[model samples]
Target: MGDYVLLAISCILVNNILLAQYLGCCPFLGTSKKMETAIGMGMAVIFVLVMAGAITWLLEAYLLKPFGLEYLRTIAFIIVIASLVQFVEMFLRKSIPALYKGLGIFLPLITTNCAVMGVCLININEEYTFVQSLVTSFSYATGFGLALVLFAGVRERVLLARVPKPLQDTSIGLVVAGMLALAFFAFKGMA
Candidate 1:
């Protein structure tokens, strides 16, 4: 339990996927212009990441390893992630139209998010047990959510602040992200 808690905290604040490793910058910068959209994207990503990790772990342990098909891990994992995202989108559209409407596009976008696939690959490479993989997946998702929401909040403020002509949009956003990354670096000793 203590180890799990520590791993969760470390992943969320110290080794964040977005801030620390710079993974998923596309969604971090592109979808975070609005708080609502950021939150929706974060939640959807969390769901997809955990599901992808679990499914990929099982496939690697059962199908890939047994058949000596480790060479196809990347392709297999990607197919599983894409198919899972599609299935989730369809399920939500039919059962929860409100959520589907809110996250419909983001659901599909998650297929290529990189962060989801990255977590699965990390778990496989690290040889984490099933429970450890689950915990790490949740932690990675939490970090992704934190980064998304934090950037959304910063972007909201950036909209109001007066800025130079050249750095009004993406340039300023990059600077702000750099600062946030520095701040997250302060948590290096947390684990």
Candidate 2:
């Protein structure tokens, strides 16, 4: 139990997929313009990441490894992620039309979100057990959500602040992102 707690902390604060590892920057920057959209994207990512991690681990353990078909891991993982994205898209579109519309193109883009792929691959590469993979997946998604929401909050504030013409919009966004990443670096020693 204690090990799981540390693992969660490591994934969330230390090895964050966004601030620390720098995956999923596309949506991180795109969907983060609005707090509501950011929250929606984060929740969607959490669901997809956890499900993908579990499914991929089971596939690798039961299907790929047993059949000596490990070479197909990438292709298999892509298919699984794609399917999960489709399910999320459909569910969101039907249940939460506003968020679904707000997410727009970024919703489908989750299929290619490397953060999801990266964590899945990390779980396999690290040879984590099933429970560990699940923990890592949830923690990483939580980290991504935390970073995205925080960045969104900061970006919202930056929008209202006075700024030089040259440092407006994306220019300042990049600077803020750098600062946020640096702030997250403070947790590196905790692991």
Candidate 3:
């Protein structure tokens, strides 16, 4: 239990897939312009990441490993992640049209989000137990949500602030992201 808890914390903070690993920045920067969209995107990613982790772990352990098809891990993980993203998109579209629309094209873009695929690959490569992988995946998603939400708050404030013409829009966003990444790096020492 303690190990699992520690692993979760490590993934969420010290080894954040987005902040530390810098795997998925597309939606992070794209949807973060607004709090609602960032929240929606983050939730969608969390749901898909957890599902992909579980499904891909089973696939690697049972189907791929048994058949000595380990070489196809990348392709297999992407397929699993992509399928999960599609399912999420359809579910969101029907259950919550506003969120689906608010997310805009970012919903579909998650299919190619390397962060999900990276979590799947890491779970398999690390040889984590089923439960551990699930926990790690959830933690990673939580970290992503935490970052996006926090950054959204910052962006909302930045919108009203006076800024130099040269450092507007994404330029300022990048600067903030760099600072945020550095702040996340502070967690490394805590581990």
Q: Estimate each model's TM-score.
A: 0.93, 0.97, 0.97
Candidates ranked, most accurate by lDDT first = 2, 3, 1
Which parts of model 2 are misplaced by more than 4 Å?
A: none
Name the runs in model 3 displaced over 4 angstroms.
Answer: none
Each model's C-alpha lDDT? 0.89, 0.95, 0.91
Q: How many backbone overlaps does candidate 1 show?
A: 0
Model 1 quality (TM-score): 0.93
Off by over 4 Å in 1: 95-105
Give per-residue CA lDDT, model 2, range 72-187, as digits (tens). 99999999999999999999989999999999999999999999999999999999999999999999999999999999999999889999999988888889999999999999
Our model 1 lands, by Cα RMSD against the true structure, at 1.6
Expressed as tens digits, the lDDT of each residue in 167-187 for candidate 3 is 999999999999999999999
Q: Write the per-residue lDDT of candidate 1 for residues 40-93, one digit (tens) a residue.
A: 789888888998889999999999999999999989999999998898788778
Tell how far residue 102 is off in model 3, in angstroms.
0.3
RMSD of each: 1.6, 0.9, 0.9
